[model samples]
Structures are given as C-alpha cells and as structure tokens.
Target: MKIKTLIVDDEPHAIEIIETYVGNFPEIELVATCNSAIEAFQILQKDRIDLLFLDIKMPGLLGTELVRTLKNPPKVIFTTAYQDYALEGFDLNAVDYLLKPIPFNRFLKAMEKVFDGYRPINRQIVSVQTDQNKSENFIYLRVDRKTVKINVRDIYWLESLKDYIKVVLADRTLVSKQKISVLAELLPESLFLRIHRSFIVAVDKIDSYHSYAIEILGKELPIGRNYKDACRQRLQN
Candidate 1:
C-alpha cells in the first residue's frame, strides 16, 4: 500500500530537497506540495494523506496551528530552520523534527519511524528493497551548483571541512557543501569506515593500520578515541 504524503513549506528549494528524498521510497506517493498552511489545510480536508512533511514557520498560519485544527491529523515530521520549535513540535506528537538542510540519512531515520508505526505488513519487503538499492554503487552529490554522480568504489577517503566534505578519489578530489557525517550515511557500511570525526576512509583502500591511525594512499589519519573499538572490529573482520 502506498503511503499518501504531502509536503508543506514556503521555500521552493526546501520542498525540492524533500521531493528528491521522497522519490527514493517506492511506498510513498506524494499528494502535493503546499507553500502555506492555509493551502495545505484545503488539501487535507479532501485527501487521505498518511504522512506530512510540515514546515513550522509560515507567513500567516503556522504549521502547528494547522495541525491543531485538524480533528485527526496525519503523522507529521516537522521541518524548520529554528531549533526553538522542537519542544513544541514534540508536544504536538510529531514523528520527527528535522532541521533545515536535512541530511538524507536523518530523513531516512525519520521515515523508518513512519514505516514502523504506520505499516508493519510491508516492513520486510520495504527493508529488503531499501537495503538492496539505497546508494548501491554510486551517489549523487551537489557540486558547483550541479548534481554530480560519484562512483562508490572510486572513493579513497573523505575529509570533513566544517560545513563541507572533501571527496578524495583515485585521480581527483571533489569538494561538496555537505557534512561528512551525512555522506558517511550514504555509503555502504561494508565498504567504508569512519575512523575520526574529520575523516572517513574506504576500507579497501587502506594500505596499513595500527592502534592509533590508518594509512591510506601513504597518508596517516588518526582514529578518533570514540571510534577506535568499532574501527578495530570492522578492520579485523
């Protein structure tokens, strides 16, 4: 069964990001995108939406206010730039509160909640398909205002630069305006290892390693204290 979904946000770019993420899930059927709470309210009265991706702050009517007005509101995942609205969002029984520039990994976590709570019958099938295909061999990343596809096997290592991540490949490096933690989530766990807060290395690309650091392409990257145990376990097996 398809999960009828609606996205309500004033920002066109924000809506676009959500739309792209939603497209990955075959079970979700996006009903519409609304630019305002008033516009969304109109659609809610007529449609049978199972899930809502709602932006908290709007021009006039707030997303929370619109939810309150509904006699039986659909499962909501609140999206906002401000962190202040988190408490209020939870009070309204939101499935999740997403910050702006939502990471695909974070969005996946929120969607897991929706799937678990709303549809247990299709859980096994969804999980199997999602695990099989989600970022199987390549991933699309925004670089220089365009989406670039990077082969997963081409990656040697990744370096985090605050708000940006440097993707090091066999022949070249591509800098993307995304968190390394977010990019890590997109890669296959069997092929990658997060050795430090600022670094993630391709497991197969490692030339050598010790208790302290990992050697990749003749460069030594320190293993974070918190990640040492997991790193050791992953490399050993």
Candidate 2:
C-alpha cells in the first residue's frame, strides 16, 4: 500500500517545495499541508495518515507538544529551519528530520521508506522479478508506484539521515525514507549490521575497521554509541 503523507510547515515556499517534491514520487500521497500545529491536530483527527513532515515551530502549539498528545502517531519526519531542535526531535522518536530548502535527492531518499518492506533479500516483488536459481541475492522495491529490483549483494553501505536511509550500492544507491531503526529491522541480518544511528554496513563489503569508524567502498561510516555492541560483536564473530 502507498504511504499517506502530510506536510506541516509555516512557510509557504517550503511547503510548496515539499509538495512538489512529494508529487514526483508515486509512492507518497499528500493528504494535507498544515501551516500550524493546531491544523495538524485537526488533520490528525480526520485522516489516517502514515507519514508526517512536521515543522518544529508554529504559533499556537509547538510541534514537540503535538507529538506528545498523540496516542498513536504516524511516522514523523521533522521539518524545520532551526538545528537546535534536533536532539529533542529524536527524543520523541521521529522517523527523520529535514532542514529547510529541501533537496530532491534527499527527498527521494525519504520516499524509499514507504516501500522497503524489510523482508528477506530473496523475497519476490511484483515489479523486480528475481530468480532463485541464480544465487543473486536481491530485493525489489515498490517506489513511486514503480517497482525497481535491487541486489543486496551490490550494496556498499547504508547511511541514515533523520528519517531517511540511503543504500550505497555498486551501481547506484537507493534511499528509503525511513528511520535507522526501521531500516535495521528490514535489511537482512546475515549480510547487514547496524554500525551507528546513521550507518549500516554489508558484512562482506567492509574494506577496513577501526576503533572509531568502518570503511566501505572508500567511504567511512562511524559507530553510534547506541549500536556499538552489535557492531563489535559482528566484527568479533
């Protein structure tokens, strides 16, 4: 099923940019654009939204307080100009946090979260057909309503940005618009390991490992303190 999304911001230009960007992705449906946290509460009362792009600041109510009131909230991607709210935003377990003047590349990465089912790599998707006999370990993703098949074996690493995760593959990277925790759940346990809040690595693709970082495909990924145990165990065994 396509994920339903809402864009909440006080800026018209930022709202327009996000709406246009979301329009390009077939997987995301813009349910409503809320200019204030109060409006978001009203929207929530009516719609069964799957995702939210929320602004940190607003006039009547603060975005942070709005989240606290929700009994069950759709995954949220915080949208704001202020960088100071980053820590508080994550404390509430927001899916992703985006700075203003949003880029298409980054937005596209966020859209990937809607379709990454996080099943086994061998699973068959309606769009990208995989042959079980070929020993090609890959998965097909339903993105923008179009199915694209990706081989897990080709992945160099995974990077997390607030609510988005980028899969660095050999040919091209795929971005899943989701949290690091969600991606960690969906990717295969045997081939992938969470190295940090913003990073994951393909076990076989590691080029080097150091006290502070891991090198993969010439890119270095750091180890988040929250995830160090799993990463260290993976390296040891």
TM-score winner among the candidates?
1
Return the TM-score for each candidate structure: 0.56, 0.49
Locate the minimum summed-lDDT window of 10 residues in model 2.
119-128
lDDT (C-alpha, whole model) for all candidates? 0.85, 0.72
Task: Report the poorest 10 consecutive residues by lDDT, candidate 1.
Answer: 123-132
**TM-score, prediction 1:** 0.56
Stretches off by above 4 angstroms in model 2 are 117-237
Question: Model 1: residues >4 Å from true position, as ranges?
Answer: 123-237
Could you give candidate 1's per-residue lDDT for residues 1-237 as a string of tens digits?
889999999997788678767766767899999999999999999999999999989999999999999999999999999999899999999999999877565677898899897655454322212353544676666677555667789999999999888999999999977777667656888899899999999999999999999998898999999999999999898
- Candidate 2, 120-181: lDDT as tens digits: 23322233222433323544343455555566777778787675667788878776554555
Look at candidate 1 and give me any clashing residue pairs: none
